[model samples]
Target chain A: AQSVTQLDSHVSVSEGTPVLLRCNYSSSYSPSLFWYVQHPNKGLQLLLKYTSAATLVKGINGFEAEFKKSETSFHLTKPSAHMSDAAEYFCVVSDLTGGANNLFFGTGTRLTVIP
Target chain B: GAGVSQSPSNKVTEKGKDVELRCDPISGHTALYWYRQRLGQGLEFLIYFQGNSAPDKSGLPSDRFSAERTGESVSTLTIQRTQQEDSAVYLCASRPGGGDNQPQHFGDGTRLSIL
Candidate 1:
């Protein structure tokens, strides 16, 4: 079984301020993790992914996430929040065992960037 | 051509009506996935297809939801007896092959409204 949990349902930050969205996961096998963003009326976009590569992964629009194996967390962060960064963020996990294509998604965190 | 494409960007249907959503994956990609996102919620995995093998439908909420894929190309999701709770954005994504690390490309999705 594989699952992910987004600790916060919502996160608010001022433009130019730092932001952080927390996530955790549970998988029986070596897991592949991903972060995705979706703006209103748009499709989901891949932000970044972790597949046992580098623990620290950088993503588009100046976003980044760190995979903490000990903590079972892959939290997204940014140095500055832009108005465009205000969107829904999901943390997903996929178990690599047997090459399954299923991706378990977190409930998501709605980021609100105030200008 | 450059990315995944979905048809009928939006659909409005009455209760008990059936709806079909189409998706064209990136050329040569052999892995396709379907997910649903309800208003103000995170994405829910529905199904996945890898090559010509049997699809994994474990995530589908109910029997009313069904999907089909032809070879490694186009795919369709059909919802029968649509209910108000079925109103959501249906997302289609495709990944190159079944590699555990391959990233999935997503389409803008079809927004379905049930009345």
Candidate 2:
């Protein structure tokens, strides 16, 4: 079984400041990880994914995440937070060998960017 | 459509009523998935379909929740005898073909309010 956990329920940051959202996972096999962002009343959009190619993955809107195997972590980070970056972010995991092709999502972290 | 499309952007129904949510995957994409997001909660996988293979319904919460995908294009999620607890935002996603590491594109989703 594979599962993801978002450590923070909410994270508030001022515009122009750095942002971080913590996530951890447990998987029996090597896992495929992803970070998705959802704006209010909008569809979930893929921010980035880690499929074993790179440990440091960059995504759109200046977002990035580093996959640390030893820590079982894939925390999302932004060098500078923007007001428009306020949204709900989910960390997802999928098994590497399962034919199910389904993803397991975390509870999510709501980012609040202050102007 | 350039992206996944979902119908009935918003639906309000009373308890014991049945609801059907529809999803149209992107043209040429062969994988479809259904997920439910409750208020302040993470997304829960409902089902997945790939090509002509039988859907994986392992994540469905109950027998009342069911889904069907015609080939790899259109999919419908049906809830029989919906309850207040069934209120949620139903999300549909699709990817080009099927693989372990493919990133899924999502629709805006249908907000179902069961009263």
Candidate 3:
């Protein structure tokens, strides 16, 4: 079984400050991880993906995430918070052991960028 | 290029009514998926279709929920005798193939509100 746990249900950061959203995963096989952002009333946009490739993955906007196998973690981060970054962030894991390739998503972290 | 498209951006209906949601995936994509996102919750995988192969329906919550895909093009998800619990944002996604590395592209989703 594969699952992802987002450490924070909500996170608030002041503008110009750094931001971090934590996530942990449990999977039987080597997993493919992804971070997706969903703005209000909008579709989910893929921020970045780690497919057994680079451990440090950079994404759109100024967001990025690092895949840590030993820690069983993949935390999203940004150098500075922006108002437009306020949205729901989801950490997802792809399970291919069954050959179905279905995604398991976290409960999501709601980011609030404060001015 | 267009991303995945979903129909009926918003749907409000009385309980017990049947509703159909549509999805148009990106051209040439061979994999389509259906997911549900309840208020304050993460996405729940509903179903998956891949290139004429039997769909992976294990994620479907109930028998009332069903989906069909036409070749690699459009797909429809139908809910029979919908209940209040069925009220949520139904999201449709598609990827180029079943590879774990391929990130799923999502639509804005159909916000279903059961009255």
With a 3 Å backbone cut-off (N, CA, C), the pairs that clash in candidate 1 are: none
lDDT per residue as tens, model 1, A6-108: 9999999999999999999998887888999988988889999999989999989899999998899999999988999999998888776644655678998
How many clashing pairs in candidate 3?
0
User: Interface RMSD value for candidate 1, one decimal?
Assistant: 1.5
Off by over 4 Å in 1: none
> Each candidate's DockQ score against the native complex?
0.69, 0.75, 0.75
Clashing pairs in 3: none
Q: Is the docking of candidate 2 incorrect, acceptable, medium or high quality?
A: medium
**Candidate 1 has what TM-score?**
0.94
Top candidate when judged by lDDT against the true structure? 3
lDDT (C-alpha) at residue A110 in model 2: 99
Which model scores highest in TM-score? Answer: 3
Query: Model 2, A1-115: lDDT tens per residue?
Result: 6778899999999999999999999988888899999998878999999999989999998999999999999999999999999999999887755657657889999999999
Clash counts for the predictions, in order:
0, 0, 0
lDDT (tens digit, per residue) of candidate 1 on B2-114 = 89999889999999999999999999999999999888877788999999899999889999999999889999999999999999999999998777677789999999999
Q: What fraction of the native interface does candidate 2 get right in terms of contacts?
A: 0.80
lDDT of each: 0.90, 0.91, 0.93
Weakest ten-residue segment in model 2 chain B by summed lDDT: B95-104
Give the proportion of true interface contacts each model preserves, from 0 to 1: 0.64, 0.80, 0.75
